[model samples]
Target: MKISAELRAFSGRLGHDFARPELLQRALTHGSIASTTRPDNQRLEFLGDRVLGLTMAEALFSADRAASEGQLAPRYNALVKGETCAAVAREIGLGDVLKLGRSEMLSGGRRKEALLADALEAVIAAIYLDAGLEAARGVILKHWADRLKNVDSDSRDAKTVLQEWAQANGMTPPRYVQTARSGPDHAPEFEITVRLDDGREAIASGQGTKRSIEQAAAQALLDRIEGTT
Candidate 1:
């Protein structure tokens, strides 16, 4: 099957020429635009998530022969997480080729983190199906080479790092409390305070989604904890 010039360009960007061009098309198609004749990427995304994890795990294991599983696990997670996949998708301009429904397009589905990440994973699965493990690994390693080089020893997010520290110390998980919220509905600023079981706490304020604000609070508390250690 012949694909559009845009998809042919996307195939170039993805660094994989398709033997089964339909696979590439399905990989770029979202559920919103799926029909009886056209399938979505959900199944592809599911398979691709495992493909990504395995590729990253192998890369991390090989890169650090002396590192423990604990160290490798977080680094592996940091590499394959939705945020990281979305970043890679953006880097490759995957959003420009995505096929979305009208509502999804209007809501900026192409720019949505979850959508981008899922689509990227789907694309990986498509590559694997079209070629083989080596081909998929080559693509993943090529795209993730820089991240592999620069990944932190403990690449987990601040919240996860803090939670694990608390657990290791036999303390309950850190809790985030929202003290205040300001600004209009569309754009709001939030103040969050993260408190540990030991009564130690730190405050932070940010403007974004609630999760980002909570992360800021957690990072503040982690900074304080690390400073004294």
Candidate 2:
């Protein structure tokens, strides 16, 4: 099968020359544009997620022999989270080669964090299938090297830390409310408020989906409370 020049370039960026190019093609296909002729990457994404988790776990365990599971769990989550995956996808310019449907393309699907993250996982699975687990591990470690090295800085999610703080202080879990939303249907800005039971609160605005925005808001609040901002 003849592959497009664009896909060839994408493979170059991905740092893996696929033996079965069709796997790469299927990995790049989105559900929005899937059909009998072209299947989507959902199954690949599922498999890739497990591959990513195992690779990250092994990396962390080997890198820090003295660290307890408590310390390592946060680092694992930080490395395998969708936000990190989306950031890696952007680093490799994965969005430029995505096969999105007309509606999705029109709605800026290429820039959507969730889509990019899922596609990146699918690509990982494709590499694993094409070669083996070692190939997938190589790609993941190459892309995530910096993050792995700096994993100790802020490994836990902000929300989890905040919840821990609240419980320690004999308070309820922090509550997050979507105070406002604006912009077009395709790209929206979210304003979220994170409130503590003690009347302390923080407000922040973020771009992308509501869930991510809420996390960002919680992080912002945590930063402020911890005097890290």
Candidate 3:
């Protein structure tokens, strides 16, 4: 399989050359593509998810001397969250490098936040495999620096914040339910609703990314319940 010049140029810009360029190719491949033609990126996505977490944890530890796991976990979670990853993928033009099936391409898979985010993770995993942990760490730190920079005390996880808000006000913790799910098996969009004890509810739609959409739903609930826009 021929890797595009654009992808090569992009990887060069990322400052690391993949020894297994095929990993990069697999990273860019979505499940929507025909299996015989293009390999799916799911395995890489799984590996990348853990690689990103570990890399982010190391970065946070090195950057902040005083932060505990309590403080660091949320920041790490926020940094590697799907929305942030999708944003980074878009910033790096990963969608343009994606190999999609004709139908998925027409369905705008390139523009879907979930696909972009998953592909980004796959890329990170590929980087880790092709090069090493350090190479992947560099890529993550470079792309996620801004998000990581605000990783001090104020950086609370959405679920924690939501729960705290509910508890402080003498209310019960919020509950999450899958209100709806759409799309094919490989690429599904989820609609989650966050509900409080008194039946006050906030609904939000998101993609396959659990962490991101959960945070989004939590944010929506926080805003609505607190009446703070």
Specify the highest-TM-score model's number. 2
lDDT of each: 0.89, 0.91, 0.82
lDDT string, candidate 3, 59-128, tens digits? 8888888988887777777677777788888888889889998998987789888789899999999999
Q: How accurate is candidate 2 locally (lDDT)?
A: 0.91
How do these models rank on TM-score, best leading?
Answer: 2, 1, 3
Give each model a TM-score: 0.77, 0.85, 0.69
Error of 1 at 202 (Å): 9.5
Q: Tens-digit lDDT track for model 2 on 105-157?
A: 99889998889999999999999999999999999999999999999865867
Question: Which residues of candidate 1, in runs, are more than 4 Å off?
Answer: 160-209, 216-229
lDDT of 3 at 100: 97
- What TM-score would you give candidate 3 relative to the actual structure? 0.69
Clashes in model 2: which pairs? none
Model 1 clash count equals 0
Ranking by lDDT: 2, 1, 3
Could you tell me which 10 consecutive residues in candidate 1 have the lowest summed lDDT?
182-191
